[model samples]
Target: MKKNILGLLIVSLLLVFVAVNLLTGNEAAPASSLEIQQAESKVEEETVKVNTEVNAEIPYAKDFTLSNLQGEEVSLSDYKGQIVILNFWATWCPPCKEEMPHMQSFYEKQDDIEIVAVNLTSMDVGLEKVKQFVDDYGLTFPVLLDEEDIVGQQYGIITIPTTYIIDQEGRVFQEIVGAVDEQMLEEMINALKSYDE
Candidate 1:
């Protein structure tokens, strides 16, 4: 009789414990889709913040004044409020030859951007050769002459056709080491505009 009473007491305690848990709603539940999306969005925003920090290291483009093909002085600061494509190229570089037409096409199509094509004249044969190349390609963009290689040294142009994408705020957005086509230039401009927005 005493054993039966102990078993009944244990059963009753277990039942009470379950009833309390059910009443308080202390049960595990799955997360909703909306909560998951919010968490993912937060992670994406944090990733963008980290990328922006990395870009801050190469903050601004270096300013320099050089003479264009017209023998007029042109400074990088002249296009401060515009998107500047600071292209470093030489006359003998095959890749430079490859991109001049595309650069010209992009320049004519887009009025909102500036192409500051700096010819590495010091490395090339002469100013006459640079002029002839520009004429042959019909590149109407401002072709600045790096006659003394001052700007080349400043920009660290170890490779031919090194293009720096400078934003409207004079920040170096990107550096394209080789040749770039018209489509690439368009996409880069659009991306920079979107980033600014």
Candidate 2:
């Protein structure tokens, strides 16, 4: 198989975009803005401190176990042999909300891929709010709870709606830091399929 060059380049550009987005805070919809309302609703801006430092090099996606709404534990290893779209998001993020329909639609149509919408549970308003968000969005994909932010910290998730597409071999195939539409998602998955062939 060819090296995952497309994935690498996308990740590189996304990192640069994220840095610029943070410094300017002028983007129409920065990924950080996804949960901004929740932040404002709870903490005053004066009390909010932004962490400028992040792990410059994100390691390979690590295996983690998180609970779903059904209270069952799900792990990355369990999805072995299938492609996984591991997404980190929160209920209060607008961009995350913007992207979920596309993700859910793709999940419903795709037979060979698994979509795991990992909710930043620690940052959400409450469990009831997450349930409401899921019900409102009509999402059928497995929604994992990162209640302690452990997986987010491990993945160096500085932004909401951060997505890592893991290939069937359990390798990180691609990473997108912002919202993605259906066409883009389909193209990426198709490219991965072609690579495997």
Candidate 3:
């Protein structure tokens, strides 16, 4: 059932991409096989904001505190004035690793959005392993360790790479269930930023 939903989400995103291209007159003059492939990949890479389009049922993101890599305590409400990407992931997940670099890029590129990477500590090998992973990946964003998995349980994070894009009001604007790309992250942030302005 989850697989079916994910597939549907991808297809929906592709349709949105084509629609945007057509509206903006950004598509190629003559649609070739290469153009078709580019359109699909470009749309997938840019990603689409959800919840309204397909009516994805995501709860209001509740506030929680967790310790970052440096042992400093951080809370979700701490970023009250900014958009936040609350990503739940584990070091062991391949898709998590694949999308993390893009997440890092998004974090670095945007000053208005905060990316707090919550590590499923109980599921990961150890704190040392997480540290090594962070170092190896050059992740500069807040790498939080969910030591007790309490926040994970509260969020009902049954899958790795589950992400919540919270608005300035701390509302869950979108819930992404899979890995996210840099372009997608940029688009979401921009879309929300526009709403605030």
After superposition on all CA atoms, what RMSD does each candidate show versus the true structure? 13.8, 18.4, 12.7
Task: Name the candidate, 2 or 3, with the larger lDDT value.
Answer: 3
The TM-score, computed over Cα atoms with residue i paired to residue i, of candidate 3 is 0.73
Itemize residue pairs with steric clashes in candidate 3.
none
Q: Which regions of candidate 1 deviate over 4 angstroms?
A: 1-58
Q: Write the per-residue lDDT of candidate 3 for residues 89-196, one digit (tens) a residue.
A: 998999999999899877887778789999999889999999999999999988889999999999999988999889888878778898988877777777666665
User: What's the distance in Å from true for residue 187, model 1?
Assistant: 1.2
**In angstroms, how far off is 127's CA in candidate 1?**
0.9
Candidate 2 lDDT at 84 equals 91
lDDT of 3: 0.85
Candidate with better TM-score, 2 vs 3? 3
Ordered list by TM-score, greatest first? 3, 1, 2
Predicted candidate 2 versus true structure: per-residue lDDT over 1-197, tens digit per residue: 24598888889999999999889886675547648877785563232222111233434569999999999999988998999999999998999999999998999998999999999999889999999999999999999999999999999899988998788878786788889778778877876677667
Predict model 2's lDDT versus the native. 0.84
| Best of the two (1, 3) by lDDT | 1
Count of backbone clashes for each model? Answer: 0, 1, 0
Segments in model 3 whose C-alpha atoms lie over 4 Å from true places: 1-59
TM-score of 1: 0.72
Q: What ranking emerges by lDDT with the best candidate at the front?
A: 1, 3, 2
